[model samples]
Target: MAVNRACHLIEELGCGTVLNGMLDYYPTKEEVQKVTVNPQRINKLLGVNVPMDQFINILERLEFKCNLISSDKLELEVPSFRLDITEDADILEEIARIYGYENIPAADLEGNATAGVKTENQKFMDKVKENSIACGLNEILTYSFVSPRGVDKINLPENDEKRNFVKIMNPLGEETSVMRTTLIPNMLNVLATNVSHKVEEAYAFECGNTFTPQNGLPVETKKYCIGMYGKEVDFFSLKGIVETILNNVGLKGYEIESETTNSTFHPGRCAKVVYNNICVGTFGELHPDVIENYNLGQRVYVAEINADLVFENITLVKRYSALPKYPSTSRDIALIVKDEVFVKQIEDIIKANASDILESYKLFDVYKGSQIEEGHKSIAYSITYRSAEKTLTDEDVAKVHDKILSELSEKLNANLRSN
Candidate 1:
């Protein structure tokens, strides 16, 4: 047994030449420091009744030589195979394991436990994700790294700020050589792939980060993108989905302004979503050129929202108001205005002039046909007036409704359309 232990220790300690019968093994200077063990500590930790002589006998069986250093402490020469035996507790553990694990009694843990709660930010993200999934849009996860050609394919202008993307120094290939500056290109690719595989319609969304180069470093911004393509999808279809998400997130006072600046979106069909005077994102129909570039055979409507900005401005503290006690009055007004006058302008005019009485107003119908004049279109709007204190009669609603029509006519050259 001693010969086997010696051979194993020599092999482990890299003293192979000692077994070749040429040179004797000499301990290195660092190995001369002996490990100390206390029999009293072992007995206390393991709850064992072991004498000093019994401890020395057990260590000798494991090929560890010991010498008495004090009344309770013994200096031990640790063998190479038992490299883990460093401190007094480690030697105690070895004695317990070899002696018997069934000998030690288990005790209950003692501490006070606390429950966890989600932070406001985590709760906000969870709500946003829930609303997105509820809007018939499946959530998708895509790679942050994308091809450099994606920017070019989107038809972004040369001077467009989004054209600036952080390049990967050690890229795996050309396809993934740069960080994505926009999620639209990847979304379009996904839709195109689905269409190629005979899938008729696809509605998907992703909430992820986009990278942009700034001041010789990469800046990450969180963004949410949604893409829908099918026979039934159009500008208004996707617009309603966008509104649903924003409303559910408890955002207010945001407007979707008609967009004409981006070449990637079809002209006159896209709009920039604005909140608190900040352009949060853009949504519209994909331009024919962009769709063709991706080989997408069908029309596509996409919207991208700046999630970071939205979350920063989100009102997590909700306040509830009691329902109105009195009935509200509604009036319909149809006007023929030049095509240049956007619906947002009319809505803003009504909202500005109607004051506190104007509960809400919405565009119900927009018509442009051969029966209408060459340069003008008929737009119909429904305006509602209500009072918190009492019911509003027709006379009261007509007063503010006429004021809104007058302002629309004067400011936008809008003329009241006859039935």
Candidate 2:
């Protein structure tokens, strides 16, 4: 059978040697001084008309033994398994695959065609993956090389600078030896491998690049991590899907705050997603020993974000307003305060004292227990009070909502939860 298909193409090309039985290939005066060949680079890469004695009769009918070495090169020899004929356009694609690309001749394709626009950081990461797939998430794409026990399974902290990473000196083991400096421990190990295959309710998300080892090179960044689990994933349902992917990346005044130094989150259910003032990421409820080190039986809720600081603080030009012709007056209030008062310090004391018909305020409700007292906590907000030239009544929002409930009762001593 043709010597068993030439001994399976000389043992699939690792062709060492095989004398009398026929398959002896050698070539190594530095692979015959690196097999040169240039009849004008085989007539400018096979556009054909290959002359110089038909390119030295197609290198002596492919037994390739050439020699001339320079009035335009030629040295040839190659055959220790023809290690991909090193260069000169791989011997002009092996002379257009043995000079029979139907005798070559198909030109017309030389220039001007352009029409491919996207950059503005790829249209702001495609509108942050179209608002994280319209909020139901599911994008996941893990492994920017992980597992240095993912910073001790996200318990991180012993001098945590995300446990300073970037190892992989030749890793293909020890669980991919390092590089990911946080993408929520591989998006909580892919939502704990889709909740161990039965997938109760995921939501996942990831938009990559994390590395951080600076100074010896490796700075990467561009993040966005998100995760979720079922049984109503908490921490305000992943802070309303990280404020709808930072309002689909056009970001804007951002601020979330409450995070207490990140031992992989959950210290008071976490927060910190600031903006113009930088911090740009962190969302909570995962640290129950990082959900039992990823066994993840429900309740996950995560968020990473800093998608390069929301692509350098987004808002790529947009300014439209003019539709308030009056009619807004909401007002709810409720206070009682002291569990270390911070509803962004009572919305920065109703935006530093009702800066004119307040028009927005939210925290719907947040009580503590037994009608609230021992160390206190009752919250509740609602506010809104608009006017673009008319109609905000209820005594025009009760005199700036009673001077924002009298400066949340004289600077956060709070107390007003009666009826």
Candidate 3:
């Protein structure tokens, strides 16, 4: 496992292919100054007993090249090809002792075998990008590194699991020290630049890997970041844009609630877009603080959806919903209930009492006034009742209506408005 892991690291570091024949020879060092080495990793994984002379002979015979090394082996110039190899003699010993070259086929091979169809996750992202592009969203690319101030400004959790990124060995400066916990900060940067250049109504999205902690390991999550900037942008417009994206991908029966607030959004204007009852992403008006931080001139409404959450919600076949053959009898009722009484709770009570008769329900008005008690609001809802079997009659609806009013009164202590 260690050898394979080392080989993988070497490959990632742009060392030649893992096979012995493909391995690039390190240049001889001009000076044998003590190079800082990760002694444990090197000794346990790459220690060798082969003579340095024999290793040099093997490399020389293969016409393998290296940096300047004197005959005495006292000092040698570091080879550019050996950038990934940190320790002195570690690279040479690894080449000499590790021997799997003879067994590998000499010819270049093609991976033609169909690796089962693209995973559902992959197809979902493809659909996300495709739909986003179709809706006039441009693809964006940004760095993962974020500054401390930037992180704080974006209101990231101090000990956030996602913010625990792999730190650089020697970071250039503090400004680029930490890995980004969220995409909003960088997206805001993009927005600032575009606004400065006089771009109007920018619609952009990005899909990339982000590092977050999972069981003490930095797990890479492939995430999609979306942003929108325009003078006229607002909550519902962005909601419409997101609905188009979600509906196109067939993740139906999702819900959004304005209660899910984030530091990046206007407190009353943000919503958490939930799918399968999981908090997947958010949509809202950019907070005044965020707008000022980015020096953005126009208001921008933005949303981000977890593509993985989306794909998980994807179904293999579309479920069908029958159109109402009978007219939906909708009733509007305004209840003066305590502010603490959730409209959702009242709606749920109505649905529970009405059983299958309630086809759909929506809250169209929420009022607070001197006519009502303090700390209480009047909520008005239009609930459409229908029956699957046949047209629902007024008498049939009245029976369910009485049941709904009774349930609401009992559950929420709500009083229905009287004419």
Candidate 4:
């Protein structure tokens, strides 16, 4: 073919073409490939069953050599120059190309479409929102894109991981240029807006995703934030509401750990919720500086929880029993300890030493004044003792109470506050 083309080109020009010692070295031309063709398979793929003879005729017209191997099967030899034809599907495609696609029959799809339902994760999120609403908080949604100044406003340290945020290359403006790392700032903005409107009380929560700069792409996590500011509301009051929401979400065996160094919150007033040795959330009064930054005239409490962390520690099994027929007894014990001691530490010691009859316990009062040393505070708890098998005896309650006191005194350097 190349020699003929060269001869034709020479004839068109004045130069004459002459044959010399021509060394043709066309390296490794493709060999003819072979594939087995099944008529039933082709029929299934095409939807219309073309007869065996018709299928062979289609392949022959496409320059594919076909040999009958069985009553319903044929071996097809693909043209060597057609390197793309390597499989039965390829041969079928060649037949289809020659047969024309428009000639293929069309049929309507046949199946019943089932309605979609909420996934477990979606259902649980709904439950969380329902419980948050039940606890007197209206849900709010804010843009995940926040200003880079948000971290500065929250007073995050230079080395904080939340400081490493994903930047939007084409941002709307500087105020919305970066992804949010914490939802507390957004919640605070909502409170600040309410304050600007002269609204007295403002309690709102947001459930949304926060982005953290990772190795390549940023990591996204769902976070839950609750912000509160109003009359008759304090740190502990907000803590109660948080606890109620967590309880409703079926979380148990969690500990309240004091976090006194976070810049986003007031020192000594912030507490972290820990489950299985992981910090799932932080809640407390907002730092005075942060409140001032947002122009919130009064103290504002905020709780920001990692919803994924909470989801990991949520209890799935629920056990119920008939109402206890046995009567329960309560005991009040006060311990004077260093001001740095958290309620969680005291409760941990109590829980470690208490017997199985220890039903529940709660911190009722915290005192720090002249009645105690300058560096010390007195904390008290009301413990209830009961048993499902039988009513707890005085001796049983006395034994557990003494053990708890001993543990607190030995482990925490706590002095019994007896008047």
Show where candidate 3 strays beyond 4 Å.
1-112, 115-118, 133-137, 145-148, 170-178, 198-200, 213-217, 229-231, 252-261, 274-278, 297-299, 321-327, 332-346, 362-382, 405-419
Q: Provide the lowest-lDDT 10-residue window in model 3.
A: 32-41
Q: Give the RMSD in angstroms, all C-alphas superposed, for model 1.
A: 8.8
> Which pairs of residues collide in model 1?
none
Error of 1 at 203 (Å): 1.1
Worst 10 residues of 1 by lDDT: 17-26
lDDT of 3 by residue, 246-325 (tens): 88988787877765347778777787777767987888788887788888866877776676677777666966897767
Best by lDDT: 4
Clashes of each: 0, 0, 12, 0
Backbone clashes (count) for model 4 = 0
TM-score each candidate: 0.74, 0.34, 0.59, 0.68
Residues forming the 10-long window of minimal summed lDDT in candidate 2? 24-33
lDDT of 4 by residue, 1-419 (tens): 88878877897895885566567797996666888878788778888878888888988877888899886688888877788877788877776777778988788767987669997778778989999998889999999999989888888999998888889999999999999999988888889999999999988999999998878988899999999999978998889998998999989988888888888999989999988888999999989899899999999999999998888778878899788889999999888999888787888888888868888998999888878889999998999889888877888888888988888989899998975
For TM-score, the strongest prediction is 1
Candidate 2's error at 288, in angstroms? 8.4
Q: How would you encode candidate 1's per-residue C-alpha lDDT over 200-291 as one tens digit per residue?
A: 99999988889988787688888889999988898988998999888888777788898998899999989998997899999999999999
The models' CA-based lDDT, in order, is 0.86, 0.80, 0.71, 0.87
lDDT of 3: 0.71
Q: Can you write out model 2's per-residue Cα lDDT over 251-288, one digit (the tens) per residue?
A: 88888889887888778878888876778888888778
